[model samples]
Target: MSIEHDAHASGRPAITEGGPSLPQERRLVTAIPGPRSQEMFARKRSAVPPGIGTTLPVFVTHAGGGVVVDADGNSLIDFGSGIAVTTVGNAAPRVVERVRRQVGDFTHTCFMVTPYESYVEVCEKLNALTPGDHEKRSFLVNSGAEAVENAVKVARHATGRQAVVVFDHGYHGRTLLTMTLTAKNMPYKQGFGPYAPEVYRMPMAYPFRWPGGAENCAAEALAQVTDAIDKQIGAHNVAAIVIEPIQGEGGFIEPARGFLPGLLEYARANGIVFVADEVQTGFARTGHLFACEDEGLVPDIICTAKGIAGGLPLAAVTGRAELLDAVHVGGLGGTYGGNPLACEAALAVLETIEADGLVERARRIGDLMLPRLRALAERFDVVGDVRGRGAMTAIELVVPGSAEPDAAVTGEVARRCHAEGLLVLTAGTYGNVLRFLPPLSISDALVDEGLSILEKAISSV
Candidate 1:
């Protein structure tokens, strides 16, 4: 295979403003898992547990903009932004600068012991940026699961209710409580038994798979959800109704229009806190700053992570001030919840997103990728559906002439893309959806190249 370094291939600049200035092109100098990566994989198998799986197993030496450079010098177009953690791009200049300064000043003072300005600043940013204009309080954590766990804790504490309502096809986290809340069984929660209690499941407005056609999905789903809550869990006993605006692991399923609003109204009327899990859809990845903003759905609480800190391990739960304040002082905190370094990186990430116009960049990415994906759907019978918003997009794979999921074809396409030097990811409840989470800093040329690789992979499959 041959590699090109031209920026004009897709009529967009190759240079990234706040990220590493790599050539922004794909280059293959060896097989997918080159010698070095394979060697590292061997060591990883011994050192790491088999449970910790890898996507491509290509050891990355450096990654920036739209490309991840491997140890053997193979550069692959990054369609998955470290699972949507590097929205502003890896090693973003501002993040690097801020992290360096914070590391030099103080690494970890433990926010619970002695809070720092950066931590407070990050909370302030979260309070300001999250969905509602109502006064809100924010709590920081180390991961999405922690944010979610804390959100549930706050909701339960505020409402004095034990039951938590979760929707089908939602991916909360791997924690015991969140695992029970999540709908998927395999990989995330198969052997992990004796799960948390008081977690009730509800139907979601999955348009493609709805019993009625897509047109009637929202109303029907809403009715079913409300009815289920009333009959199964009793709305009065529910503490929170947690949902992902765009179900990430559940195949990037964006509920039909009005679905979220309907749920929010129900939650409000029933005194159930509505929690929007934006772990995968937040921080400008979905055109709007948060996917909830698209529907103008002001959730009672919003959980965020991934792109919040430019790849750092930081997550936050921002919600109405009264609810959050309901928790007793010192009741919500962690040893390394809001490390100074991570807080600094988050502040820089927010600034970079605003100054670099990453939100618009995400929309541009969707504009460039969605049409080509839809075209691929037209060409390939296996392409069941192509849907998403902004940079967070996906194509569902299904058996031809039917909606039955084809996980085999999905795996094959991803494998082929890996061999051809394109980094892609698969998602969905059935593992038949190919999700694309390209960095907001990716160039048009790289986007075109990645899509080309994906097209060939899908065709070959």
Candidate 2:
């Protein structure tokens, strides 16, 4: 397929094709999971374990800008971006070129075994690009869970404390420690037992679900969190307070204004490390390079992944030199932590974000999505709330005339969208939120079309 470099007025190349120049428009040649997909799915069921669940079982053969082509040749508009891992889009030109070059040079030398310059370069980029201007150091990992675990390890080593604090509805990762840090119990922590020790959870400043009301959420939540830390787990004993600026899996809940700043002040005064898990909100996905930037929050440590390497399995923990370096030598690292290929792809991804002005693009996406979603909320009583920042937006479904969560309606709306060739995702602690994470490279026309499909789906439901 011939790739064209059609630059927009903003100097960013407008991606109008999927892999092999697959047309950007949605095309349903067969029912979602056609015969071929069904066959493949049957094979997958036989080969893979039941623990691994799939949202849509269609077998994808190719994907790019804003669509994934299935094995049956059906083209579906992609709103999930593989859970915010492809901010620059799948098969992004820069990422592809860099990976190609790096693969030809050498695949992996194992950074721990033989350190490489690409790893150093990636860390340098992270230290320079992360929110603060302080002297920072970073270490790479293979996934968000690893990064979160390492962050906690560093915090403990630096502070000599065992207690780690997290917030309600926050998701860190799936590792042993991260799972303990996570708030949700079902599906994620149901069968898993013997979770990590000394992990404490506090109330989050969730505006829509606050006890009194949205207006009083921030102050109450701050007070509750402070009390929880002071009374439940003494402040001096706490090593770190980890949180997601904009909760991802727990719904795209943006904390009430002033809430994050208050927590930062408390953590600072008490000498506890304030860690922001930006796994899903980092890179240009949240308007700012990091969601904490919205409140000028400079966390002691920031765990980043998802959109870091254009869909590659890469993660990083960027933090102050004193905190990150406090760990003894050889205390942090993994075999595939900073694979050369992923490092190269990350460098390219960073370049793409800057050159494409994707941060502004994310804000533009939010401008287009929020009003429409809010309008839906106005029309449908089931849509209890619509919230999020930049391209990461969501609508929480609830029983009409009540705040009771309506997970059934959420599922129905998502199913309807899938049937119509739109790929949306569901989230939230109660499974009542419909989240949208569209690729920044997707065209406005495609976005409008997707929204139109979503409207019909919601109306039908």
lDDT of each: 0.90, 0.90
Give me the runs in candidate 1 sitting further than 4 Å from their true place. Answer: 1-19
Mind giving the per-residue lDDT tens digits that candidate 1 earns over 1-461? Answer: 11113432443644544447566778999998999999999999999999999999999989887889999999999999899999988888889989998888888889888778988899898898887789999989999999999999999999999999888889999999999999999998999999999998888899999989999999999999999999988999999999999999999999999999999999999999999999999999999999999999999999999999998999999999999999998899989999889999999899878876777778888999999999999999999899999999999999999999999989999999999999999999999999999988787878998999999888777
Structural RMSD, model 2: 2.1
Candidate 1 residue-wise lDDT at 260: 91
What's model 2's lDDT at 423? 93
**How good is model 1 by TM-score?**
0.97
Residue 433, candidate 1: Cα error in Å is 0.3
Using alpha carbons, what is the TM-score of model 2? 0.97
Model 1 residue pairs with clashes:
251-428
Residue 434 error for model 1, in Å? 0.2
- Candidate 2 local lDDT, 343-400, one digit each (tens): 9999988988887778888887898899999999899898999999999999999999
Note each model's CA RMSD in angstroms: 3.1, 2.1
